[model samples]
Target: MAAFRYFSKKLLSSTLKTDIRAPVSNNYVVCVRLLSYTPMPYDGNPDPGPIFIKKEVQTLLTTLTRVDLAKVYRKRKLGGRQLEQPVYKFMTDEQLQEALDEAKRKVDEILQIPPVVAVRKPRDKVVSRDPALQGLDSSNYIFTDISYGVPDSERIILVRDTEGTLRDADWATRDRINQMYFPVARRQVTPPKMFEDDKLDDLLKRGEYNFILDRACLQFEPNDEFYQKVCSVTYQHINENNKFEDIRSTRHFGSFAFFIAWHKMIDNLLLDLIESEHIDEANALVELYAQLHGEKFRGNSIEEYIGKFSTKKAALELALQAYKNAAKQKHALEEGIKRAHGLN
Candidate 1:
C-alpha cells in the first residue's frame, strides 16, 4: 500500500508540470491542496503510535488560466502593475535609438539659432549752463534798440541777429549781456584773515567775553534789572508747584519726553514678542522703531514681518493704556493741588 501511494504522488507531480507547460489552446484544470502532519509520541511498548494528521480545507486562493496569464503580461508591457519585468523589453533597440536621435536633432536645431541682441539708443547730450542764469536768460533779455521809457504807447521792437535777420537770441550773446548788466552779487564782508600766534591770545580773550555775566548792583523799582529778577523768581515758583504734573504737558520738553517714552515702550514690546517665540516680529519692531532710539537696529521695512501673535499685540495695548493712565493720574493730582491753593 505504501509503494502504491508513492507511485500515485509521483504521477500527480508529473501531471502538474505538464499542465503548466501546456499552450493556452489546451484547457487544463489544476487542483492544489495544503496538508499538515504531526509526530505522535511512542509509549515504549515496542510499538509505534498512530500518526496524527491534519489537512487544510480551504479552496484555491487564485486560478489563473493561460489566457489570463497572457493578458497580464500584455498589460505589464504597457506600464501596468500586473507583472514585474523591464519596461524597455517592449521596445526594440532600433526604435529607442531612433527616439534618441530625434531628440538630439531638435537640440542641435535650437543651438544653431543666434541669440537676440538688445539695441540701445544714444543718450541725449546735456548742455552745461550756470543753474542760476537758466531762468533769468529765458525771461529777461534786453533787445537792442528797445527803449523802456515808452510806457503809454505800444512799442513793437523787431528782435534780429547780427546779420540783420529776425532770429531767437543766441545763448552766447544773451550770456554776455547778462554778465554785463545782471552781474553776480559779490560778497559784502570779506572772510577774516587767519590769526597769527601773537594775535591768537587777543582773539581767545574776545571769545571768552561771551561767558561773562553782568550783575546789576542797584535794585531800583520799575527798572529792567529788578523786573527781570522778579520774573525769574515767579517762573521758578511756578515750576516748583507744578513739579508733580506730567512732563508731557510742557511744549518742547514734553515732545522730547514722549518720543523717549514711545521708544522705551517699543523696546519692551520687543521683549514680549521674544517671549512669545515671535523672533521675526521682535526684530522687525526693533528695526521700524530704530529712529526713535539712538540707531541700533536698521534693516528691512516693517511690512516684511508676517506674524500676527495676538499675545504681543495685547501686551503692547495694555502697556500703552497703563502709560496713559499714569499720565492722567499725575495731571489729576496737579489739578487738585492747584485748586486747593486757589491757583487753578
Candidate 2:
C-alpha cells in the first residue's frame, strides 16, 4: 500500500497540474527500453579450428608447454569441497608409484589446451507475444524449470518482458536464472571483478596470469566470451612483457604457446628459449613457426634457420651466441677438471 501510494502521486496525477506524466516518470520507461535491445552478431575471424587438429602442432604446443605436474596439481583455494582434509594413507612404495602414474595420465584431460575459436553470437530468441499478459505486472518475469537430473543447457528457461513479449532468456539471463534456481558448487551467478578490463590490467601487472586462467577456467565454459577475452589478453601480456615464466608449468601454458604462435609474435619466446639453453624447444619452436608460415625449414639446423627471422633478429642471435659461449666454457671447465683428476 505504501509503495503504491508513493508511485501513485506521479502516476495518477493530472497532466495539467504536473509536467511529469506516468509514462516517463514512473519507471515505465525502463521497461520500454528492456525490450528495445537489438541483437548484433560479434564474431570477426577466419575459423582457426582446423589448424588445432594437426598432430604435429599439438605435439609442438605440448612440448613448448613443458608440463610440470607439481604446478598443475599445486595446492590452491578450491572453495567448499577443497577445504576438506585430504585422505592420508600408509602405502607401499609400489602403491605410491602406481598412484603417481595414474595422476600423470589424467593431466591431459584436466589441462586440454584452450582453443581460439570465433566468439559465439547472442541467443535472445523470442518464443511468443501475448497481449493478455500486458499490464498484469510492472516488472519482467523469469521462469525456470529446475528439476533434478536435468542439465542446465537442456533446461527450459523463459522470460516475459514488461511489454508482454515472451522469449528465451539470453545467455547472461539464463546463466543467472539457472544459478539462482539451482546453484552450482563453485560457480558464482556473477563473475568476479578481476575479469573487468581495468581490474584485469591490474592483475596482469601483478603477474596473476595463473590465478586469472585458473579462475576463468573454473567460472566460465571454454567457449564463453569472458573466458576467451581474459585468456587472450593474458597471453598477449605474457608475450609482450616476457612473463612466460609465470604460466610456464601451469595448465595454461599450452594455450599460451598456441596463442603466441598463432599471433606470429614468437621472437621474444624464441629468444627466451635460446637464453634458457632449451635447444630442443628452440628447434621445436622453429618447426612450429615454419609450419605456421607455410614453409618447411626442417632441412637446416636451428642456428642456420634462426638467422633468417625477420623480427628481433639481433636479440635472438645475441642470445643464441651467449648460450653457445656458456655451453662451451662449461664443457671446457669439465675437461680441465678431468685433466686435474688425471682421467680421460
Candidate 3:
C-alpha cells in the first residue's frame, strides 16, 4: 500500500515539472522580446557632398528637434488658428522718406499762419456816478449807526478807529437800516425762467436764447456735476438746432459779454486739450486765439507743435480761442468739455 502511495507522489511531481518548463505562445514570445530589446544608435555614413543651408534655418531645425512632440503639436494647431495678420506693408528706404516728408509738409501748412492777438471791442455804454453821492463824507456818521448796535457805543468810542466800520455790519442789520432810512422797496426774488422746447423758436427770434453757453462757465471744473449738466443741455440744443436749415446764431455771440465769457470758456477747454495730450491741436487753437485777440502767444511755433515745449500763458490763450470757436460752432465747446472730463 505504501509503495502505491510513493509511486503516485512521484508521478505528480514529474507532471508539475513538465508544466512549469513548457514553451510559451509565439505572440507572447514576440511581445516579450520587443519589451526587453534596447534600440541601437544610428551609425549612418557621413554626407559625401557639401550641404548649403542658411544659419537661421539650421538653428530653427535644431531648436524644433529638441522641442517636445506634445508642445510641437500644440504650436502647430495654434498656428493654423492665427487671428491676426500684419496690416502694415514693408516700405523701401525711398518710400519711407517720401511718406515722412509728406507728413512734415502737411504739418508745416497747418502751422504756417502766425498767431494773432485777440483784441476786445470797446464798450458802447459808459457807467455814470451820481455827483451828490460821490463826495459825501461818512466820517460824521455815528458808530452805532454804522455797526448797527453790534458794538457798545462806549467800546467803539474808546477804540476810535473807523476804518471799514460800516463794512463789518451783518446782512440783517444792513438790510434793516436800508429798509428804515433808504425806504427803497425790496426786489422780489424770483426763480430764473426755465427754457422750454416750445419757446425755443421765439427765444431764438428775440435773441434771448439761454442755451448751454449760458450755464457752461468756469465756475465748475469739467468733472463737476454742474459742468456735465451744462454740457448735456448744450448738446441737446445743438442737436435740435440741426433739424432747422436756417439756424440763428446764439444770442450772446458777438456781444462783449459773449467775448469775455467765451474767453473764459477757452481757458477751460485748453486745460481739457492738454489733459488729452492733443498738444498740436491745442497749440493751433492757441495761435488762432492770438490772431483774434491781438495777444502775444509765447513759445516757438515749431517747438509748440512738436510738443517739445509749452507755456501756461500760451495754454491759457489757446483755451480762450477754443472757447470762442466753441461758441461759434455751438456744439464744439460741449464736445471739448466732455472730452476734458473723460466723458467722451
Candidate 3 stretches greater than 4 Å from native: 1-192, 195-265, 296-344
RMSD each, Å: 51.6, 16.5, 40.3
**TM value for model 3:** 0.18
Best by lDDT: 2
lDDT of each: 0.31, 0.74, 0.35
Off by over 4 Å in 2: 1-44, 77-89, 130-133, 145-151, 291-293, 301-309, 324-344
User: Which residue runs does candidate 1 get wrong by more than 4 Å?
Assistant: 1-311
Q: Give lDDT tens digits, candidate 2, residues 104-201.
A: 99888767876656565678788999988889899999888877899987798888998899988888887788778888777889998988877887
Tens-digit lDDT track for model 1 on 1-344? 22233344456677666876553223222111111111111222322111111011000001000112222222212223354565564558998899767765554332221111111112222323334443333343335434565321123322332333343343334333433443333311221232222343343334321111111111111112222232222222222222212211121122122222222333333444444545454444444344333344324332122222222355454544555577689999999999999996
lDDT of 3: 0.35
